[model samples]
Target: MRTLLDLVLPLECAGCGVPGEQWCTGCSRALYVPPVVVRPRVDPGVPCWALGTYSGPRRSGIIALKERGRRSVARPFGRALAEAVGHLRVAGEIDPPELGSLVLVCAPTRARAARARGGDPVLRCARIAAEQLAPETVLVPELLRMSTGVRDSVGLSAGQRQSNVAGRVEVVGVRRSRSDNGGARTGSCTVLLVDDVVTTGATLAESARVLKDFGVPLAGALVVAHA
Candidate 1:
């Protein structure tokens, strides 16, 4: 199924540029380590975990997916997220209620930015992670959204970054857990926020605040990297 363009341009690892593989074994191995608990500048009132610092293969992979449009990298990123969730469950850091589903809510991005980037890479990764953990897990992709006119947080101070996203994140809808047979479940489920990176944790904190206001039960947040 190799196309002519692929044959001419060739496939290169998004993380390390090793030819012939979209994601090389070495780069994929880099993301398989134990998840590290991180304390962000702004706490979201819940445990925050990251795979690693935003460097090396992690940075390259994120850039490839977000800026270069190398969508294939989402598979490895999603698998890493699923593994992290499993680790949290094993360590007792996260516990989904009995007979209820574990919901993965993707941190929202600005619609304009997402449109320019082809789509939301973070949401795509979250969906894949939910699929890998499914039957007991579900994905709520549009549970949150960034309101219009919010500035980017690229070079803002931690406080400034927080101010930028505060009051700008809006919850669109609430999703209740469903059973394996596709029937509605009754008890409360745990909501875990998923994102690509955690810098000052401004966005995550804001997201948790809105979800809390909406009466959603949140367990914690997970990110691919901690900046």
Candidate 2:
């Protein structure tokens, strides 16, 4: 069915711009490489992993999904993310509590930006990745939100980015824990932050801080690419 639509509309691959396929095999292979540990300017106080650098196919696919409205490319990206998660689990980098699931918490986007883009692409990719890991994994898409007045982080310095999100990322719908132990018990679920790209890592840092304030401890963070 997609091939037929491609024939009629002549769609291009979001990664390589090759005609017919939404995401070509070569580009898919590029994202399938081993996930690597990355250090951003602002630490999120947890391990951070990225599938690839923000370049070539990875960069192109992200731009297409977020700016060009080419959502079809999300599947391959999500598959790559799932593969990274599986590898981390096998490698002992991500250890869920016994009898608990690995929970993916998508990095929040502005409601206005999400509306303009039809939806939140990061959340969409996370959802797809969670589906691939279902029964053992879950997705919490609304755990965080960007407060109003937060400016876009593009072209901002690391410090500026940090300032922009400082105290501006809010935890949503999560009740404050009454325990003095300082960590919320989320059904024994191990939480992992999910995002499409990480630049200065300010957003992730702020997100983790806010979630912590709400007593949700993050195990780590995962991204499609690191700039």
Candidate 3:
């Protein structure tokens, strides 16, 4: 049975107008045909990897997931992100052990924004991607949280984006255990920050800084698309 929502608004490829598919095979082929490796001008060491540029179906699909309430699209998006991770491995950009040991950390969404969207789209994507990547992989969706009133970075200049998110996000949850001597155990896990898109690299960079305070280092970042 077709879903009422689908019946009301027929499903079509976001990249090309094809009936009954969100992302067709042709677009998927385009997404990773040429691996998109962005040497972050902001932070060189943490090279960014994306499945495709944020245009056409990629951008439309992302917007559908975040703003248009198409949460079902996350499955394909997650698999694509996993594919990007595989690309990193194939290019020798990431070691196998590190990839297995790394935790997936989803970018933080503002409290109000998450409520309005019904849930955290990025976190869902991160969780799904982790599942696709490896069975043993852990996902720390709430590792970071943005401060209230942090404005969305859309349409903002790079400098403006930096200022908007500066001092506005921080680590919230780090598990602590008592040692034999009753001392607290510090965080010792590496994270792979995941986001829907990477533009100015401000958000991922800022997330790395916040995680550093808690003794968690980021191996790199993965995203569905790049701008």
Candidate 4:
């Protein structure tokens, strides 16, 4: 992991460019805002909650994780994500996610992109969040796979984004919930999609659609930032 790589690399604050801090407390707090629920106009099953807008320290931190290989920031963001998810409540879900019942699924990064980045930072972040939030809750890293030939959604209009990812994500594995201790957990397994950021909500929507088709419908979604 990148954190292991940090033994040689210096730790720097991703948000404010401060020295000797992977992620400053102030910067972390800046990301701890009220979660915004995102539901695209077309699909509603995949409602998502975002910590804040994609700007400021949050944006800088994400960029640092994805591009600069600053893996230290993932822990704080993971903890922040855990807190946000703890407070998130979706319609028809009265109680908090029961232990071992919730599973966090990372939105699939393109295979090409994953190789380019050395690995998936989003998946790493989601794994940490799931561990910190509930060790009983499983984290499924390979649950979703981007359909072949899917292009990057950047700069595309909302409609285009939706169209681009439509039928472009598929479930490639069996949905199962297992604790960190290697024992299978009880309760039905329901997915909660995790992403680094959400803009038009198309990717998450399409992901939810695919998962639902596989009979693993989403409980909801959690993203670090909303653009």
Q: Estimate each model's TM-score.
A: 0.89, 0.91, 0.84, 0.84
lDDT of 3 by residue, 69-127 (tens): 67766767777777766777678776664534657888777888888986888887777
- What ranking emerges by TM-score with the best candidate at the front? 2, 1, 3, 4
lDDT score for candidate 1 against the true structure: 0.83
On the 0 to 100 scale, the lDDT of residue 45 in model 4 is 71
Ten-residue stretch with the least lDDT total in model 4 = 178-187
Candidate maximizing TM-score: 2
How many Å off is the CA of 227 in candidate 4? 0.8
Q: Go through the candidates in order and give the clash count of each.
A: 0, 0, 0, 0
> Candidate 2, residues 7-100: lDDT per residue as tens digits?
5566778888898778898998998877899999999999999998999999999998899767777789888888888888878898743645
Query: Candidates ranked by lDDT, best first?
Result: 2, 1, 4, 3
Model 4 off-target regions past 4 Å?
Answer: 1-10, 40-44, 89-94, 175-187
- List candidate 3 segments past 4 Å from native: 1-7, 32-35, 98-100, 175-190
Better of 2 and 4 by lDDT: 2
Better of 1 and 3 by TM-score: 1
Q: Candidate 2: RMSD over Cα atoms?
A: 2.8
